[model samples]
Target: MLSKDALDTLFTNARTHNAWLDKPVTDAQLQEIYDLMKWGSTSANCSPARIVFVRSDAEKQKLLGCVSQGNFEKTKTAPVTAIIGMDMEFFEKLPQLFPHADARSWFAGNQANIDATAFRNSSLQGAYFMLAARAVGLDCGPMSGFDADKLNAVFFAGTTVKVNFICNLGYGDAQQLFPRSPRLSFDEACKIV
Candidate 1:
């Protein structure tokens, strides 16, 4: 079990930052986030999440074109905007990632299975990514308010990858944070079987 302070850091006190400080998020920190996130479990171990970290002004400008008006400012000001993508052909690498069994054969040529697994596992990976970022002392602002088609064309053209979501990573501006929203209690949200 983790300590109370650690748990607080990961969940209880974590916030979805809408603004960021001027501090930069480094390449080393980004690598650390992935290193921690990659260990999260996935069905058939199909690790399909591919991230594109947009830091340069050129890349940020491209991203700005795809985001909604509501997301424009936060995303623009963020030090690092991570594009979380899902690869439709992720099964091809299963041989190397899950060498104990023929995992690739299970998803290859099956468009339905491939799509389902890719989306589901990539979504799971996306959640792991946020947790990993928080673990590394970075704040996260995840958003789905973007033109997915445009983003895909801009970031993953001619590839099987599709945008799942985007998240801004940085040292957040706490003064800009809104009051925490309410969440359902365990009994309200879960059932003991």
Candidate 2:
């Protein structure tokens, strides 16, 4: 079993941090987070997630226009806001990530399969990203309270990528947090069929 500290750091102690310090998240740290997330599992290793880190004022302004009002201030003030996305042309990389067979052709011309694979893998990557950020001592505010189509139009225009979610990354201000919310008990949330 994992230590109590490990479990707490990853779950009980982690909060959805909305307020941040003005400190910056270094590019090296961002790359390290991606490196850690890349090792996490995915179907056929389709690893479709693509992230764009928006840190500049102009970029932040563009992102601000795309986010919902509830998320605007937190995102705008974040040291980095990752635009987690899925690449539609992800199958092209199958040769490197899943080379045991002709897996690339399996997704060709199959829109349903393509959509399923991209969304699933990208979602998995997002989860991995959050865990990795926590492991690296960074605070995360993951949100889906935005228009995906507008985000795509603003950030991913002319590209085959679509935004899956936005994660504001930085050092969290615990004082700004509300009291912790309750979660379901094991028996209430799970079934051991």
Candidate 3:
């Protein structure tokens, strides 16, 4: 089992940062985050999450155009912004990913099944991405305040991938964090079988 400090790093004390320090997130660190998050579970091992780390000024500028005004400044200032996307064609690789079974045949021509699996599994991967970022000593500011159609055009124009959400990653400014908000109690938010 993980120690208390590790648990705190992953969950209890981790905060969604809105302000970032002036530090760079290296390509190696970004790769490390992916290498960790890639191990997360997905339906049928379909593993549909695709990430684009926007660090260059050119890419960041393109991304800035699609975000809501509320998200603009923080996104612009963060060391890197990860565009989490879902591959609509993810099932094609199921033969390679879930090789033990003919998982590819299950959704090859079925649009509804493909869409449901891609979106759900990719969303789960996005959560795993955030935890992996924290594990790598990076702060995350995840947000959905962006124009998906515009972002898809900018990042994945002719591909079958669709934008899931975006997250800014870097060292955060602690002074900028707000007070931690309340969460639902287990009795209020959960149920026993």
Candidate 4:
């Protein structure tokens, strides 16, 4: 079990940050975060999620044009923004990622399975990415306010990868936080069989 402090750091005290500090996130830290997140499992180990870290002023400007008005300032100001996407052809790597069996053939030519698996697994990986970021003491503001097609055209052109969401990463500015929202109790949101 994690200590209370650790739990708070990863979950209890973690909040969706809309404001950012002027601090910079390092390349080493980004590498470390990906190293940790990549270990999480995916179905048939397809590992579909691909990430693009936008840290440069030019890239941020490009992204600024892609985000919705509500997300403009936070996204533009955050030290880093990650574009998380899924590779529709992820099954092509199954021989390397899940080599114990003929995993690739299961999804090969099966567009429906490929689509569903990529979406589901990449979404899971995105959650893992957030948790991994939290574990590394960074704050995140995940958003889906942008036009996915536009983002894809801009950042991932000529690739089968597609955007699922964007997350701003930085040392957050707590002074700008909104009031914490409530959550449902166990019985209210879940049920026992």
Candidate 5:
């Protein structure tokens, strides 16, 4: 178990920010987040998540068309929107990522295996990404309310990658936050056995 301060910093004190302060997230900060998130474990070490940082107005406009109305304003005003995606052909990179064995062959030509691996690992990476962002003093707004197909078509066309989620990163406006929501208790949401 972690210390109370560490746990609080990562979870209790971390808020899902919906409004930003017009502050830009430096490229170095983004790289730092990636460096931290990449250390997170994945099945067979198959890290499938790919991120495209949308910071320019042009890029933001491209994403605006894919996100729903609820997410449009917040995402548009954010300093950076990370397009978190999963690569269906991620196994091909196993030769380098999992070089100890023939891991590539393990997922070769299997659509179900590929999809499962991509979705699962990418989702795991997404969680890691959110934590890492919080750890590095950035507020995050993670949202799934978007048109995945349209996002993929606009950003990942001609590729085997698909959008899983999007996260807006920047300095948060605490004044705009709603009351904190409730959470499930350990016994109610977990299994001791």
Candidate 6:
């Protein structure tokens, strides 16, 4: 088991930051985060999360136009805004990812299953991404207040992928955090068979 502080870094004390410091997140740190997150479990190993790290001012502006007013400034000020997307054709890579069996055939003609798996696994990956960022000493602000159609059009043109959400990454300004909300207890949230 990880130490208490290690767990705190990944979950207990991690906050969804809306305000950022002027510090820039390094590209190497982004790569390191991916290295950690990609190892997270996925059904059929369908690692479908495709991320576009919008770092430059020009790229950030493009993304800014796609978000709600509440998210615009937060995203703009953050060092990186990860456009977390899922590849519709992720099953095509099953041969490489889950080579023990012909996994690609399982979703080849089933659009419904493909959509479900892609969305589910990608969302899982996004969660892993947030935790990984925190483990690497960066704070995360995952946002869903964005126009998916506009974001897809602007960032994922000519691709079968679609946006899952946007996450701003940086060293955050602690003063801007809202009080931490309460979570349900184990009895309230879980039921053992």
TM-scores for candidates 1 onward, in order: 0.98, 0.96, 0.99, 0.98, 0.96, 0.98
Root-mean-square deviation of Cα positions for candidate 6 versus the true structure, in angstroms:
0.8
Model 5 has a clash total of 0
lDDT of each: 0.97, 0.94, 0.97, 0.95, 0.94, 0.95
Q: lDDT score of model 4?
A: 0.95
Candidate 1 residue pairs that clash: none
Positional deviation of residue 80's Cα in model 3 after best superposition, in angstroms: 0.1
Model 4 regions more than 4 Å off: none
Q: Candidate 4, 96: how far from true, in Å? A: 0.1
Provide the global lDDT of candidate 2 against the true structure: 0.94
* lDDT (Cα, tens digit) per residue for candidate 5, span 86-192: 99999989999999999999899888999998999999999999999988999999999999999999999999899989999999999999899999999889997
Residue pairs that clash (backbone atoms under 3 angstroms), model 6: none
**1-193: candidate 6 lDDT, tens digit per residue:** 9999999888898888999999989999999999999999999999999999999889888899999999988988999999999999999999999999999999999999999999999999999999999989999999999999999999999998999998999999999999999999999999999
1-193 per-residue lDDT for model 4 (tens digits): 9999999988899999999999999998899899999999988889999999999999999999999999999998999999999999998898999999999999999999999999999999999999999999899999999988899999999999999899999999999999999999999999999
TM-score of model 5 vs. true structure? 0.96
> For candidate 3, lDDT tens digit of each residue in 1-193?
9999999999999999999999999999999999999999999999999999999999999999999999999999999999999999999889889999999999989999999999999999999999999999999999999999999999999999999999999999999999999999999999999
| Candidate 3 clashing pairs, residues 3+ apart or interchain | none
